[model samples]
Target: MTSIKPGRAPSFLGGIGSAFAVIFGIFWTAMAFSITRHSPFGGVSIIFPLFGILFIIMGVVNAVYNFRQATQKNRYSVLDITDSETEPDPLNERFGPIIEGHVFETHQGDVEFEAHDDGTRDNRRPRFCPYCGDDLGEDFRFCPSCGKRLPE
Candidate 1:
């Protein structure tokens, strides 16, 4: 079975702009036609009808653009989309510890984990540093490998 993810909603401003453009376009076109047909006004300029046509074209363009934008998947990640290293792995534990002076490959780069006297073992290790993939302890306040401050 295929699961289709929900797409982002259309922009409010785009929708509103399209609606107003179409409505005003229709209104102006109608007025232009009326004036050309010898309405109460003596004579009407051609700019009104030209503007109405332009607005109608603009409305159609806006609607199409908004529809395409709405159907596209919105990704906010700063990393490259093709970079699999930074992709989320739900199966892997968030924290994995490595022995001090041990080097491991990571999405960021070769990271060396720091060893602590906290009895951290293979199954009970932190996965990587939250800021970068370095060895971190559960009780760590700062990453000794990268020198980044860690959360308490």
Candidate 2:
């Protein structure tokens, strides 16, 4: 028993080549018939039609194989995010701790707000310094990493 391993779908080039082979096979068969009808040779003339038939058979077999391979579905199950029990976190799972910053203007002037990794923006102070990206544990007048003064 022969087991075939899973493979990718047939490429565009393969399909085009198969189609050309079938067309060429038909043309060859037609030409063979015309040649045999006009030729005076008896026994040897039979080989021409035999060769044409062989070409047609090979071309048809290749075309059918390519068609079947192209249409077969993948063996593995596709990943469906919606079917999962819990929703996946895009920012935390994919990006790994990304800080999205937004600025708003009020009567007091431009105010900067940092969006946490949980995708929430509640006017909380930025956890990391904007200049050096160092962790800001508490309110500070300056960034300890780059020694830059924080904006008042």
Candidate 3:
């Protein structure tokens, strides 16, 4: 029903997770140091220091990873609700067809290009459906608007 927008930034949950990881890392590292230096809890298990140190390392790694994710541009961590019924002829209605060396059509209609001196037109393909002219987003095998199967 929903998904992350393309080229979006990270979600707020990522930052929250990163903050938790950093706090946990600091806590465990301090605990490990304390356990190794002066046994705060008497008769503590021999593995307490090792376990604390291991968790400290893991937490630090997780923090860094989460922080990096949170800072990425256009990389969202949540699904966003979208309307499938977008304007079909948005480009044709707005900018119309552009006439350069090639006839660069807008987003709504088919794009036509003129032949260059090398007797070849540009091969850049649109991400939308050439048949129904619908945006083919990231994970669809078929066009939602029309029942056309998209090329993989």
Leading candidate by TM-score: 2
Provide the RMSD of all predictions against the true structure, rounded to 1 decimal: 13.9, 18.8, 13.8
Instruction: Write the residue-wise lDDT of candidate 1 on 106-138 in tens digits.
Output: 444334344456754333445567555687667
Q: Count the clashes in each prediction.
A: 7, 0, 4
The runs of at least 3 residues in candidate 3 whose Cα sits more than 4 Å from the true structure, single-residue gaps closed, are 1-12, 32-46, 74-147, 150-152
What is the TM-score of each predicted model, taking all chains together? 0.38, 0.40, 0.34
- State which candidate, 1 or 3, has the greater TM-score: 1
Ranking by lDDT: 2, 1, 3
Question: What tens-digit string does per-residue lDDT give for candidate 3 at 1-152?
Answer: 34554321343465466567656756765776675666665546345655656655666665565556556654543565432234344554565554445554445445655556766776655467745678877777788888877654
lDDT of 2 by residue, 83-123 (tens): 11144345444543323545322223234465656777767
Question: Alpha-carbon error at 125 in model 1, in Å?
Answer: 36
Q: Indicate the residue-level lDDT of 124 in model 1.
A: 44
Clashes of 3: 4
Candidate 2: residue 41 lDDT (0-100): 78
Model 2 TM-score is 0.40
Off by over 4 Å in 2: 1-12, 74-152
Question: Could you tell me which 10 consecutive residues in candidate 1 have the lowest summed lDDT?
Answer: 75-84
